[model samples]
Target: MYTVMIVDDEPKLRLGLQTLIPWQELGYEIMGTAANGNEALRVDEEQIPDVILVDIRMPGMDGLQLLQEIRRRGWDTHAIVLSGYADFEYARQALQYGVEGYLLKPVNKEELSALLQKLHQQISADRLEKQVHQDAKSPEWAVYSLLSGSHDLANVSIDNLAKSLGMDWPKYQIVLISFPGLHPEEDERIRSFRERLVTAYAADGQSLVLYFAPYTVLLLANTLVGDFGRADLYRELQMLSGEIRTHMDVAAGETVLALDQITNSFRTARSLLERSFFYDKGRVLTLETPESYRQAPSSSKDTSLLDGEEVSFRLYYLVDVGHAEGIHSLLDEVAAQMAIIGKGETEIRERFFYLANETLRKVSPRLWSESIYPGEPAQFLAGIYSQRFIRDLVGYVTAVMERLARCADYTSRDNEMRRLLDFIERHYYENLRLEMLAGLFNYSSSYLGQLFKSHTGEYFNAYLDRVRIDKAKELLTQGLKVYEVAEKVGYSNVNYFHNKFKKLEGQSPSSYQKKS
Candidate 1:
């Protein structure tokens, strides 16, 4: 089936386009939707839809401008314009620019289906013509064959392919450009970029460029044996990588080998690129980073033993009661302990997975499936997984919890209020304020204060002060000076700290310290 992309500024119109037609029956699949012309360009790169249905007007580069850009870039994708009015001028321009179809807004189902059917027929005929005219006699095609594992060097004439690119060398290297999050799109711009890189290298002598993956481009460069050390070649590749990054945001890695070592150099280079997933700071990779580094320092602490069931139960309860702060506290506590057990990707993921699964099983069972995991459950997991560092993971998990908390309908308000008291106990020393806590836990400050008094027999500020003062008392017992103890427990003003301590402990700072 031919893929179709929808581009319109109006979300309702985009939704209508998505659901209005019998797209599947018309031999079309909805590839993706974009809000405006600029977004359509990016989505086009990722989707490469067979046909694009775009509204005539949009903010920042209208549909006409976008179609012009597509044509300028020589993208083979087709365009269908959506016009709000029967403006002959716009229709004339669209036709002049080779738009396949133009339809009025609030599209009719039959007309939309007919246009798709016609496009599919045209695409089929064009496919036949393109196939008949296709040629594979290029060095890029040869390198693609190698990278794709389609033609092994033992069975293929590498020398001929190398000669095709005017290269005959005793040593070679493969440099890989990798885009981690980019959606894969087939476009001539990428092909042309590869060709440009080949031309740049060819100026000196020998290089072949090929599209390896949707997000990867490989450049194979040949050199005379002993002409340059591997280090020198790697340095050059690093410079090229920097140059490429200036033009496009991508991480790059490289592997150098003797001419005879092309057998697995490409694979090795690609594997080297995977290092970017763990070590994101430095983009260039000359050697494989050890697998052990994939994990943070291993810890003897076991996260699962940290009462997985109890924690999961609490998390589910908090989510159900809409206790946002409680959920955040629980996730933070769990994640902190998990990090102590070694920040290994698998260990962290598995530990969090246990917590997530246990909680999800109770909260949202359908989220566990791979088919729809990309929803909330999957997004939460993906958000956590994408984090390269444990610190980032903590922030991401907390953010997800906050979002889940916002969705709480608050059926059990009293239960949430009780959880808020517990939250204050855990976070009182961290500059915990009633306003912030109220927002975090999805309650108004006035209601939060009333609930605090109801649950804990004290106002929100009074309870927070007691919690801090109690913590300060412990530090005092440990022989810390009064002012030091006060700062350690979140009190900033010494005078206010003294007043609260005097009121709670019935003594001034000097008296409390002297007694301790």
Candidate 2:
């Protein structure tokens, strides 16, 4: 369907045109409505529509100036001016910028429909004429045009183009090859497999070879001569990749008996080659691999398989325990797995940023004090996001991890132990438990229990009960009810709270408040 946009200064006119016009019945959908020229320009930058209806007599940046700027910017969108009886002079100058025509302020439905029908027919006819002109250039251009979807895929057109090029091949398949870290303008393969193509398939110079940078596409023209199939093609491509110590994917689709199917085969091969991230280097990826490997979203990441927070916690724990070898191995695994799931560079950067900013900072808070991620937190987050590639991002994150592993004893020392006691003293009215602290501090529950007992001369639960009872006594002395003070000190059952209070202070809550 054709997309359209309306630009006018009056909000009422914009709404009237949007609701009153039968745009969908006229083979168009209003993509957006803009109240000014500046707003219209910003909308078109994201997605340009096929046609635009703009007002001629607006306040700032009138339709004539908007049309002129559209022309100067080479937008190439068909524009129609909304003019009144007094603005005929401005409408006349808009024609010089290739506007379709001008419409009166109170536009009639018949005039707009006729102009749109004429423009649609002209657009379709011009596209077909351009394709026919490109198809008749040469034998190679005709073959390339057909493979690249420039020509209309009519059976008669394909037969005629094949006869004119003096070709009789009945089978075709596409093989896509890519060199990850090399210049595409220069190819350094042994050409042995390409020689095999000439001997078995396209005997003449009929093989359509095209280079789509970083990838070389081979549109193989086959006959009924040899038993060469896609499996044999992959075997030969593997040998070539192994000898050169480089990586390539032999992602070939099934052979087709029609020339029109070459486009589908080409697209399929390109999609499958993206799955090579799961395989090792110096090998090929076949059609046997599954299409997707990304995991589903979850909140708690301890059980999740592919969440970025899993890596965040794992790195922090390993750094806390001083496992140097485990940290290095995890860094490599994360990069490879993200590549396999088809994550772009931007997504990889954000994932690594969570690891650095949220989890790893707790281990060594001063870890980049003379920091790469300096200034405010926004500057620190942007520092991780400024990397241009996966290797550079991995290198930066690796440096941070190595630095953290050396200086990661923030919570393991005596002063930090005092800090933990201060944390409990500050948040004792809330529900506090040793298991929660173990997870937050990346320590074992049993180990943390023993440490708390040695430090405070009481078990973790008994110490928490005493802290809560002391706060409850203060609230009771301030004329709070027994049940009110019980709930305020983190107790849902007042009876259970009374039992704990009597055990700790040798008195019931009502008696304690009366004595105070």
Candidate 3:
């Protein structure tokens, strides 16, 4: 409800006006009354009112003076000027002060009611305009609009937007946020949540644009307008991260950009999002600082020394296919190359960022954009040659090398050995002796023993014993008794099983069970 203050020098007039009007029916509360301008100003300082009804002429510091003081203070209180004199000058001055209405002396109930209704309409319109402006500036709306691809529809070019909207060109910032491990349906849920949040911000007259994509969302806000404070933006983003964590049980990363720098922002956000494979997810990551991009060396580079396009292709392939070994090897080689160049960690990071950004630019121009090329083509080529993309290229090349290495390792294994291992894994419960496995896979027991040992780095009996013990351990953890575990692992002789378990595990099955 709106609040109104009445200022009149006559006590009876103030009392009559206070009681005569059905203030509650008119959506206002008569908060207080003052006999003079000084008292009114004091009341206003104590508790600002939505509207002030002031009498024009008074002994000292009359309504006009009080209105001037209120205006000077930057208070938005609507003024209704009441006067006994039939003076056009007083009315003009009140109008100049942006008073809501001018009421003649001995104000009639009908006239007062009509003026109050008009004030109510004016207040409603003002409120709605404020809300619209707020919604346009909200972060939630910014993110939602971006996700819905409405920014494109809005034809939101920095130049055209400023000119058409009559808004001062201000630096704009974009932040790309990503959540990994979200299933398709959960991603949809996130989009819906974003839409609701956008609506809420819009209702509050904040302008926030949101863009949603697979596994991520983009937030665009104007940094210049101070429409929404930066601290508030950070708080809201953190809140959003927390909300997603509650449902998806994962954290999200954020990358920010200045106005018209969305392409770079998206690149950083994607890079940070991909880091979820190595780091914890659902955390806000801002790329404005150097600390946010820190990452451990990729493991793929550690295992190989491949060079050129071969290295780049390999690293790309391994990361694309989720090959752990290849990824590690590529990272290791990249690290080693960076060290050889005498590059500090920060320099190494810059090299990696530039190389990855460039490679993505080549393969996925639609996504990475031409910003990767910072200078003339000739200069860029010169820099590439002098700095050597070959080392970083080797990281990618070796990623693929590790993948092929894994494949070759699998193929080079003897068929008899592979068959034996497969059988052991599938039927470790109903296992027979080595001779039985050799016969089953059509190999001599002695040859099979050597083959299994060579491929698996363990004797056939040792492998079988390890498998049984591991299974037994699992069963024991499930509350199985010692003998029950032995039976479950296909060991009829509990004594032999216990002895083998103790020999292999450094503890008897019963003791292992107890510890577990």
Top-lDDT structure, candidate number? 2
Candidate 3 residue-wise lDDT, 123-198, digit = tens: 7556644554477744444334343344543556655544443322343444454444443223455666566656
RMSD of each: 18.4, 12.6, 24.3
TM-score per candidate? 0.39, 0.45, 0.30
- Candidate 1 Cα deviation (angstroms), residue 484: 45
Candidates 2 and 3 compared by lDDT, better number: 2
Ranked by lDDT, top first: 2, 1, 3
1 or 3, which is superior by lDDT? 1
lDDT for each residue of candidate 1 in 32-86, tens digit (9 for 90 to 100): 8998888888763656888999888888988888888888888888899998989
* Poorly placed runs, candidate 2 (over 4 Å): 1-132, 135-150, 157-259, 269-372, 379-458, 470-498, 508-516
TM-score attained by model 2? 0.45
In candidate 2, the residue pairs with backbone N, CA or C atoms under 3 Å apart (3 or more residues apart, or in different chains) clash, namely none
